[model samples]
Target chain A: MSKLSKKQKWLVAGLLAVALCFGISPVTGAMHIMEGYLPMGFCILWYVISIPFVVWGFIQLKKSIDANRRNMAIIAMCGAFIFIISSLKIPSVTGSCSHMTGTGLGALLFGPAAVSVLSVIVLLFQAILLAHGGLTTLGANTFSMGIAGPFLSFGIYMLGKKFNFNKKVTVFVACFLGDLFTYCVTALQLALAYPSELGGYSASFVKFLGVFAPTQIPLAIIEGILSVIVIIALESYAKPEMRSLGFIEQEA
Target chain B: MVIHWLWVLPFVLLLIGGLIYKAYRHRGEHHHHHGFGHKHGEATIAVDTYAYHSGIAHWNPAFKVVLSIVLLLFCVISDSVEVSLIIICFTTFVTVVLGDLSFHHYFEMLTIPLVFLIVGSVIILINFSWTPMTNVILCLPVFNFFVIITHDSLYVTVHLWARAFGALSAMYMMSLSTMSNEIFSVLRKAHVPALLIELMNMIYRNIFIMADTQNRMRNAAESRLGYVDYRTSLKSFGSTISNLFIVSLKRSGHLFDAMEARCYDGELLFLETEKPLNAKLILMALGVVAYCVLVWVMTRGV
Candidate 1:
């Protein structure tokens, strides 16, 4: 075949641009693996991997509830808060609106274990109600958005505090990294399931990462900034609630 | 061969137009509030709202749950296009015809997952290579590499898309027809832990109240031009979320106090309404299962 003329080359280029735009369209706010998207084996493996964290979260929740009967109500409220946050559309310069993960704030407040439980419930709600995720893929979704993201986010917050970094900046970095890590784990999960014929899992991973990057990066940044603002607002307006949750020191 | 390749131009343009229409139709005006639909003036109440009013709402929750699970499992494991198509049709009949869900709403809900599936399938469809491959649909040359679409990738993408739609419809059948409270009751019957059930119940209940509060707060902010620009919207959203957190804390505390005043114990109990499965429904479910197995066997190795 002969090489294409300039106009034909530009036409091909325009077509490719359109195709890529459609492929990366962030029209849907959902980041979870859709129903039956993964192979059965991957589904079973993810469920097995996620069960322990969910059980541990339940145990922590049990402990807190046993210590105080009111904790059940408080925890439920937190879970509901996470659900509402995820449903809200956040403004981004990327022109693709998406929902907030809200795991960062939940992890910072009630610890990672409890946030895992909260997120599982939220994921279930999304699957059943919003059809954003799926029951079969619930394990994978929880592992990425709940278990992996919040644990790393909490770890960062603790590390930042131990080193005595600027408080607001620490919150921002922790929340931001946590949100980004959640998307990374999601991409990894997708790549594992759909490895390319050419470069196998790693190449597919890069492709998935590239696909998620344009929209998710902005969402992560928004999550970080929103977390900082929420914390500051909480400190000012909800001092008693913050102190009760042991998030703030009690004034003498 | 060149003419065959040129057909892709119109296809791409059509797809672009379809996507633009979809985007315009679902603009963020639907703001996920409690007690409403996303479409213009449609009466969609998430899942529960539909479930409560479904024509099949009185059908046994346990039966619907079990049948939906069986269909979902069959759809995924069978990996047959015929089976997926059958399940999709069956689910549409059940959810839209029998359950009396709005056809428009059902299609809208299906589009939510369809967008994600399309995006994922497209990623799987396109392949990158250093050398040319057989059955190439479109190939674009880059620096020392080629972007290609192969026949094998297209086949895999179509297979996945079919299976996902099948499984998704099954889930919708369950969720769209049965209320969350009913599902919790069924879970309780299946011996799920009481604590987790209670937590789910509370969270489900609180979700509506909080969503309403958030909706009101957002509307109030919008009235004050809180979302005029990106920076202003961020500030408004931040304050709204923080205020929502504080409000939730207060609501939970008051709820606990109210429960205690009403002689509440640590465990929360809900009254379960009994809805038994009829023989006709059982027979129909069995027929559906048999149909799936038959399809799987017939379409094996396709």
Candidate 2:
């Protein structure tokens, strides 16, 4: 509802820094890790990890629905936002073609919980109807694009505001890092699934990371910039609604 | 030197070409959901359209989903390329012959996954390492390491490629035959979380509404030279997104009021022109399962 205190800022920044260092990167094979790429066991493991988060999100969703009837529609609108943005062919970063995750703005507006729900659904749609992501690997994809990225995004936004950073720059950083971190988590997922026998997990991880850098790096940067533009535009165009959503605070 | 390594070269070149084409074509050309002729999201729109016209459109959507999943399981469990090949052929026959998709359009749709499989398998087949590889069919020196390919790797790659292609084809069959609304209804019937199903239904309906709103904003911006340059394009796109978010939020509020006016109590219900179970289709699905089992039995150790 309001700005965070200094201690809260430090806590968020610390948490984000740790997340950035660890819960890192995604690679492109369509919008997600793709289906049949990971083993059944790994997929199950990721799904198990994701269940708690999705349950928490589901609870939040039910609460929203119970609180206001319009919240359901608004949540659906957020889902549409995720679908349209992730599916759109954005400006190429490096040489690899990729799509923006569309998680940042929603994470900033609706919180990470809502984005988590939105992203899994979006990924599900991509997998089933569009044949992009696969059903088996849904959990891994969701963790990377949905949970990891959104948490990074929401963290960056909070820290940026607490540090008195410019809103434009803050949006850009939140989105850019959000994209980068999503793929980082993805690369980890892949490397874990298919570790390099010679070099073990670390080597495979680096290789996956190296493979994605040319495109993912540039893609994340552009995502950041685009998110900044989108957030700024929303500030002007949907000021009242955004304020109501608590993305913007009540006017003094 | 193993000649099998040569198998990946043509696919490699094709991939390079696709990448170059992708990099150069920057103007939001086309994709799954939004683009006019977008290459990827076509499955979503195509499936919905085809379901309406599909000969087996009257077939139960849930049955089709189960049928595809079964076929997909068969594809996944088998390691033999022959089994995957069979699965793909069977899936194609079902989609084209039974599901009623045009062969031409079907093949066009096949290219995406086929190419993706080839590209992914190529990378999977290659081992990049600091030390030179032994027993390699072909090796290429890169920056400071070697890209090694071997006969076994090639065999495995082919198997994996086939498996992915087969599994995807099975999904295509289901999607091509099942409508989105029908799929949602099936999910609802299965008791797969009422809140999620409801949200998805609304989102699915609103996607088009938002897309229209976005298109209008883009056109209005373009008419006034809002996208003449990179910076302008960025600005135009940004404002359009913000405006869409704003409009969707406001519209949702209005929509809620409108629904409430009509005595809408949160749950949005619609008619699902339900179809009775077709014995022929059910038998055919069972035949598919039997074929899969036959493949598994025949190719147990391959």
Candidate 3:
């Protein structure tokens, strides 16, 4: 049964384009608000509460690895790979730059569970070495981009499949929405943390939404196109290898 | 409003107590397992999975669905700083105590935000002019005796700092404990659109892939003595970034191709786990609702 119909393909593509238009084409991406901008007591409260969930996730990951040791090894290696990759910085328009976070790729390859584990590892290393994010806020960051991003992408992909859309269009839509959702969730998180300085709910939300729309939208689109291109290339040249890796199932 | 030192002290004590408890518990557990030599075997994974299943199994997914919506609503409706700070701190404290994390771990987590708070407050105080009354209260000798609590400047400083720390810590804990997958699951259960979730998933996956590629390229360049000097480092770094982008672009292309061949029709299949609503979940939801309502009532005139 085809997952996406022809009409669905176009719809997915259009949605992806829209998401890209709002997520990545602007400078607002640079204003990553730090912890303590909001109320301290609240920040501590949330950090404490999030522990069990994180522990639960860790437990789930451990189980998955135990069941499939090879997959576990692959995930660990990928986690290490992700750590290495995020260390390299890419220059943005401003003098300052942002590095690539390969969480998206991890999700595509191993699903969100594996990606979450990889993200936790990368986040830990980043906190200890680069001081990009605080140890206290690690749970928050992981939940925001790590856990939220992959599932969003996967859910979009599943929805597209239901409609029987074309493969290229499906991938594009999934990538775009995934990127957009991450930014949206991130904005929501920031808004929750610093609603006052951010100008309260309505104003802060609109501002936050407006800020990331440009940068993340285009970034999402670029991400979509890039993903599509890579998938198409792999289909033609590395199909067998990809299949062996369980990235793509062979048609009956 | 005249700030009462006594009122603030209890809140501080509660916060400190929570942190210490988490640290102690975590240490205790670590010690208890030390005799096992940190068993890196498959059993660890099994234990982890068991914990995840048990934890999630206890919750009613439907309750989470409702809670998320209500939480989002609270985020929108509660505009008062005092109210928000109260909510943040209370929730954080409750979560910490409930989660069984240790005091040391909690404190370690606070270290970064505390430093930032101190530095930022000093900067803000320096930049802003204060009223005479504020200055007098802030400069009170007695206030300085209790970790620098004062009326004017000190009061503002402590209030702002506490507010900031409380808010960040609350949100941080929530995000940390909640799995991204669970968030998506909650959304899905709540009937959020599938396409939105799929896109989020893809972006999540690719971020790491791109990061990895960039790191490798930088290392390769570094090994070749590419970053020996400042000028060379800049040049090398620039080229490396460009190269990374190109490579990322190429990799995305490959992923698309792979997806296409797999009959990917713009949709991803997710295995739905069974999550039934129960009385416990209902109770939890009711508790949150009641708390929110109470906050609303108390802060109505504000």
Each prediction's whole-model lDDT (CA): 0.83, 0.74, 0.52
- Name the best candidate (by TM-score): 1
Q: For candidate 1, lDDT tens digit of each residue in B183-253? A: 98888889988888888999988988888888889889999999999899999999999999998899999
Best by lDDT: 1
Give lDDT tens digits, candidate 3, residues B1-302. Answer: 22423323444577678777767766645443212111112222222232243324335444543453355335334544444454554555644665443334445445544554554354223211122223233321221121122344354465566545544554444443444455557767667545445544554455456555655777799999987775576566545543554455456556766776778765666676666678775786576557656655665552
The TM-score between candidate 1 and the true structure equals 0.90
Which regions of candidate 2 fall more than 4 Å away from where they truly are? Answer: A1-30, A93-97, B1-36, B39-44, B142-144
What lDDT does candidate 3 reach at residue B180?
44
TM-score of chain B of each: 0.83, 0.81, 0.63
Question: Which candidate leads the pack in DockQ?
Answer: 1
> Per-prediction DockQ scores?
0.58, 0.25, 0.05
- Arrange candidates by TM-score, highest first: which order? 1, 2, 3
lDDT of 1: 0.83
Q: Candidate 3's residue-wise lDDT over A59-146, tens digit each?
A: 6666764575334324444565455444433334432333344556556665676677567656744543233454445666676657
Please provide, for model 2 over B1-302, each residue's C-alpha lDDT reduced to its tens digit, 9 standing for 90 to 100: 33333433443454355444544653464433322243433445665677778877888788988888887776776655666666676777667766656555677666655555555555556677777766778665544666667776677677767777778888888878888888888888889888898888888877767766776777798899997876787677777777778888888878778878999876778888878888987887787567657656765553
